[model samples]
Target: MNILEIKNLSLAFSVGGRYYEALHNVNLSLKQGEMLAIVGESGCGKTITAMSVLKLLSPNAQITSGNILYKGENILEYSETKMRKIRGKEIALIPQDPLTSLNPLYTIGSQIEEVIKEHQEIEGKQARIIAKEVLDEVQIADSEKRLNSYPHELSGGMRQRVIIAMAIACKSNIIICDEATTALDVTVQAQITELLKEIQRTRNTAFIFISHDFGLVHKTADKTAVMYAGRVIEYANTKELFKNPKHPYTKALINALPDFNSKKLEAIEGQPPSIKEEFNGCSFEPRCTFRKDICKVKVPPCIKSENSDVLCWLYN
Candidate 1:
């Protein structure tokens, strides 16, 4: 069963007096305990899509169409009061920088306990115990002592662990990791990924991991969505997408990754189109190596195949 889903989600941002669409017909589904990774170049609408789930978008952003459903309920229709109930407790976000997410002035224990108090209605000693338990669950060492430490005192990895702890403290079923490991060292990134996998195994938690690292996505994601110029050009099982990428953009991205033995790197020729730009057809046409005359003027419909769903004229 799908725990969360974004169906035909279209969004636009108003700038100076014009509304430019930023996401186009985006469709994705996440099952319980599953990890769905959304990958793309910067400004491909990855973060915008994730933020839409929490309704934490900019004031000028508008949902032009479609629904964001959580557990079969269309959360797009939820009132702010009800949405507050959903955030943190039902769905939590682990942002890119833990330092920015944490309150420097508050002790780690106070921050964690505050979330517990607000969401779980637990107080005082019990809230503190739950906070400590969550910290221990995220594998923070010396959980007891760590509680009294402030955000500034913790290492980058430990601070991230604390952020994750807050999510666990609130018993969030779905955690959106928005480039959550981007600032960490490679070894710490590995540790955080492993910790996330462990949490999934033990708690049956679902995750939406957004990142630009194909190698990391290959290792961690169960399913991967490749976005290009505001659209999901390809989506499939991670193994299949890696082995046989369906969309030209997806293939180019994989080919562009650096090889260990060979010094050669394959880089895509052009930049992604801006939201301000208008496209009558495929947004990737300008840089696609396999572009056809039809691709120049006709938008490619999402063609569903045995192993993948791709928006490309080649699939036709």
Candidate 2:
């Protein structure tokens, strides 16, 4: 069943009395026990899109139009009080940087306990017990000892596990991981991804996994959304996307990955366009290898391809 849904969600940021669109008609959904990965280069509005669900956006940011439906209700219309109730208990965020996301001043136990107390309303002795249990659940060895340890004292991977433990402590129905494993090495990244997949399977938790790593997304995500200049250019099942990418951007991204057989690397030419620039046409027109005259004159509507839903004239 669809647990979270984002439909035609458009957003913009107010900068110096000007509004620049950041997310354009964005749409996404997360099912119970499924990991839906949003993959794109930096500044493509990946993190902001997830933050919109929590209503944790900057004051200057504006949601021009859309409905962020959570379990069939439009959460975009939810008041701050109602959002607070669901923010951590039902939807928790595992932030990108473990190094900076946690407070160095507090012990891991205290931090986890605070979340449990606030969202779950279980404090003191009960919260501490649940905190330790969640730590063990995330496979952090010697959970009791680590509880007293400060964030600075633990390894990157262990700290990340603690963050996951926080969500587990709340028994969150949906977890939004925004580049949660970016700082870790390949081995640790793989481990964290596996841990998340395991959590999804065992807890039946839904996840919105945001990352720029295509390789990791293939390994971790069941479905993938490829964003470009704040739009989802391509979306498909992870397997189908890897096997047959319909969108030009998706194809370029997959081709850019390291291939032992090809022993070659291909870089997507040109940087992504600035959101500040108004786009009557497709934002990717400047960078796209197959840019057509029509691509430069009007934005392409999302077309249904055999393997994926794509926003490009090639599939039109």
Candidate 3:
């Protein structure tokens, strides 16, 4: 069963004198108990898509057109109360920054307990017990003592684990991890990924992981979506995306990753298009090595590939 579906979704924000489109006609689906990674550079709308899923966009941003369906229900139609009920119980978020997400005034245990009590009917003591159990589940040593520690007292990895515990407090069906491991070191990143994989396997929770590195996506994502200039240029199964990247942009990104034996690394040239104006042609055409006349003059429709869908004139 599919947990979420987004069709023809476009998002825009009004700033200064003009409207900037951040996401354009994105179409994707998430199956239950699977990990889907949306990969792109900093300004490529990956974060925008994640915010849309959580309904946490700023007041200046609006959904231009399309539907976001969670379990066959339109999430856009939900009232604030209904959405509040679903936020932590049905769908939870592990935001990009653990430090900011934690409450500075409260202890880690108190915060986690508060989340459980708010979403579930439990006493303070019971909630605390559950919090401790979950903290241990995430591999936090000295769970009982760690509960008393403040956000500033714990290390970065420990704080991140606490955040994860809170996210899974009520056993949410879906979890949105937006650059969840971007702040950690290499060893910590590996540990966190393994912990998340174990949790997903045990609880059957679907994950929407947003990241900029293709190598990390390969480690965690079952399916991959490549975003560029507020649009998805390619999407496919993880193995297929690595084996046969159809779009020129996708090819460049995959080739840019450094190989262990090779001393040289190929980098993609040119910056992403500015969000100041809407473009008629492909946004990636200028940087693409395989640019053609049609690519520069008009945008291409998403074409069906052998194993996935790609938006590029080369396939057309």
> Top lDDT: which candidate number?
1
TM-score of each: 0.98, 0.96, 0.97
Q: What is the lDDT of residue 211 in candidate 1?
A: 99
Error of 1 at 106 (Å): 0.6
Tens-place lDDT digits, model 3, residues 1-316: 6889988999988998668888899998999889999999889998888778779889999899988999998998989889999997788888778887898999999999999999999998899899999998999999999999999999888888998898788888888888888989989988998888888899888999888978888888899999999999999998889888888888888788774215466689989986775678999988989989998789899998669999998878
lDDT of 1: 0.93
Q: Please, what are the lDDT tens digits per residue for candidate 2 over residues 14-62?
A: 9999999999999888898889999999899999999999999999999
- Give candidate 1 regions above 4 Å deviation: 259-263
Greater lDDT among 2 and 3 belongs to 2
Instruction: Please write out the lDDT profile of model 1 over residues 133-241, one tens digit for every residue.
Output: 9999999999999999999998999999999999988889999999999999999999999999998889999999999998899999999999998899999999999
Model 3 residue runs over 4 Å out of place are 260-264
Q: Lowest-scoring 10 consecutive residues by lDDT in candidate 2?
A: 257-266
